[model samples]
Target: MSHPPAPPTSPHPRRWLTSRARVGLVLAVPLLGLVNQFLGFFVLVLAIVLIWKDNPWEKAAKVVATIAATALLGAVVPDPQGKDAGGTVARADGKGTAHGRAVDAVTSASPSPSPTVKPGPRAADYRGLRLDRAREKAEAAGFGVGDHNASDDGKSIWMRSNWTVCFQKTGWTWSDTKTIDFGAVQTGAPCPEEDGGAVPWPKMPDLVWKTWKTARKEVVDLGVPADHVLADTAYVNDTLPDEGDYDDWRVCVTDPSADSDVTLDAWVTLGLTDPRNGCPKSDREDGDRPSLPDRDDDGDPDYHDPFPGDRNRDSAFPNGLPRGSDGSGGSSGDDDWDWNCPHTRWC
Candidate 1:
């Protein structure tokens, strides 16, 4: 008599493959000269085989097999490192993590080549557009420009972005230099219609003031030491009738100590609605000359400082000036304005 239908058995012949069989299947992929895609397929098959047994031990084994397969896939994939649209993560510290490191490598390697930043309008293109002229443009816009430095080799220029109109030096051997940016004039603004092609700051309140405050803080917090910084204002402008009513600040920095020709950091502000009250020009020291006369007679200078909060005691002149003495209802250079009032010219 024929055996009773041979006892119902598993449909898959290899459903209970031994551990060695599973390992061999995975290792055999590379040896068989199969491409990574094929190996990936095998990995899935192996996992299925191991798990089909319905044993806890088998399930654990399948998971391990899958992990091994994924590791190999990383090697074959063109860019296994996952990256964001910007090609990098927003945070720099993330690079220390495994995933972050991978993402950074992939992004840096392909790097869209930095979009070949096109050269902007040259300072010379504007003809009489020297640093002072640019400074004037910033002031007229209601912004300010702080001291800046040039590259040691003169190939690149960088400055604090605290002011609007600023310059930067760029290039390696052939050394090309160019004016990089104008201060924040307004938020979401296109190039000013009057300036022909100068980028305009957006007039939006949210973006203009908020961004300005952020940039100013960055300058104060990150600026290189003066002993390490060769500072100068290549351009300063207080009047730009064509541009909308906004202040712009610009600056440059050169790190000679590091033997680098490129400006390291720059700061600037744009679209200042109100003039920053400076240490009131001291009349106590110069009451004799009408030219020295405080225009507002508030004991403060008529011109507003691009950066208003003073930290140096020296800038505060004619000691004993009271706080809120400024005609604008703020302290003039007198109150806390001691010989140490950091804003004082002689301090």
Candidate 2:
């Protein structure tokens, strides 16, 4: 046995490992370079170490190097939109100068200017001018006439040329829509009539004995303006009643007698009384005897008696028909001495 130690077994495993390491290094360096330059450099150094130091830990070191290279390559590659690894846009010129980079940044950051707007039509003042002139001025200023109205109550003068503008809707200012209205009156006509030239003068309507509601409607039907008709209500107890709750009240008297003529703007006042106040005292009722106040013994009341305080004419006639009697509506006459006389003693 001592004559010759068995020839040392050839190191087949070590030789196999060295050959494998050389082949791995050759393949890894070029493959990694295709992925990333920096990753390829790092992998090259790692491959050299793997080849020179063939030890028990070599397998693990090779594995770790391969994984690290793969990860680094993935991080270094550009994105699909040509952005760098850090997500910044890459310049196509590839110039590294500071001025070039600043110019690129400014161009991207600047916003485009907005489009200019054209101006619109302007407004103008048209107060206190004649209607025709006002219309002309308005049209000249790019406006249109909207409405025409009377400034006061009167007949609406259909002729615009004969109208005087007292008020304008837009006043002195111009409007965007370029339209205006004129409250006008007929030329040479009253500028501010009581009825604003809206209604014509009408005969006073017969509202007596009509309810307040009916009276108001008659007034309106007669073309009398609502403001021209005034209402005065008296309750049964002589207390003022609410004007709003006068539907049940009766019309007692009117300011102007029925069938009287009145101006268009005249105030036709209605005197209303509660139904509980009984019939209104009027000469038309009961032959004017009950309504009249005759302090003396005359047959006629003071209003009709010619000789109101004279006993000689106390019961001679009705309403002092014989005009020659004194203030008392009485005179001696066989025909006048009727059984239906107000003064029975004289009859």
Candidate 3:
């Protein structure tokens, strides 16, 4: 009829987009968009139009083409730091590649607020704790501890757990190299009012009327050695007493005399007596007397008694002589016992 209907011609461009070429372009559009969004944009549009007109592609191909066209419209720039990643990339997809990278750079360049630093603790925080405990806490807090007696007693620290911290010198916070110099005392003792070199020896206190146990505590607390203090009855009742028995008896006299200065190691004697028997009139009872005739029957004997014949009269002499007597065993004074006693001592 019509001259064999002339040779059928291809609907697509003969040189590049023939039937085989169109199929290849449709499949390649997604890859092209991934490489360069600008290039992908045109190819994606062309692929969609070819698919719709010639009906050469399946429904899946058409779907792919639409998605590629919308997605490749702009470029995407991912944030390297992750701080602005979601917002930056999402914004870039809507804008173009040049605009996307510009926004990404600004987002990454913004300076983060400088991080603040925290300081460490001070040594004074550990004051009043046991030396061992304080040292542990201080070391954990990045500090070192050095300790000595706050009473200034010249004693070496052999046991840290037995001592308590009184004061500290290091004041800085969180110092790795700082050593906290601590003034310390024994666990049971109170801290000194002020730092001292050596605890001053307390004077001998009058223990009269105080129990043996009470007397021991007073001197012992004042830095006296417990063994140096002793208790005895001087045969007042010929009754030997034990520690528990001491609680029953009361102290009547002290050896060094009350108010005398004594050291920590000084030996002290307590004269015990039954409260019912009452203390003897003897000025002393620790066997220091001469043991001569006690004419007045007072504790003093004639050998060195101030006045052997008359207890009421002051001996006329000081060098062991009685009132105008010859070879009297009295030592009250020897005509002139020595000026040290008559003028300067008890009248």
On lDDT, the leading prediction is 3
- Model 2 stretches with alpha carbons more than 4 Å out: 1-200, 234-237, 284-347
Q: Give the TM-score of candidate 3.
A: 0.37
Q: Best candidate, TM-score-wise? A: 3
Badly placed stretches (over 4 Å) of model 3 are 1-121, 171-176, 197-204, 209-231, 241-248, 255-269, 275-347
| Error of model 1, residue 282, in angstroms | 18
**Candidate 1 regions with alpha-carbon error over 4 angstroms:** 1-24, 29-34, 37-112, 121-124, 127-347
TM-score winner between candidates 2 and 3: 3
Decoy 1 TM-score against native: 0.20
What ordering of candidates by lDDT runs from best to worst?
3, 2, 1
lDDT for each residue of candidate 2 in 1-347, tens digit (9 for 90 to 100): 46866887776887778767755664667577777777777776776566547544467765775566456455555434322323234355546633223222213444567896545344565655778888888877766675456644435557788777766654233434645666776554344453245423356777767888888888777656788788874322233357677776788778776877565445778877666555456655444312335656554445445567755454445343333433344444544544335444344
Looking at model 3, report the run of 10 residues with the lowest lDDT sum: 97-106
lDDT, residue 266, model 2: 59
All candidates: TM-score: 0.20, 0.27, 0.37
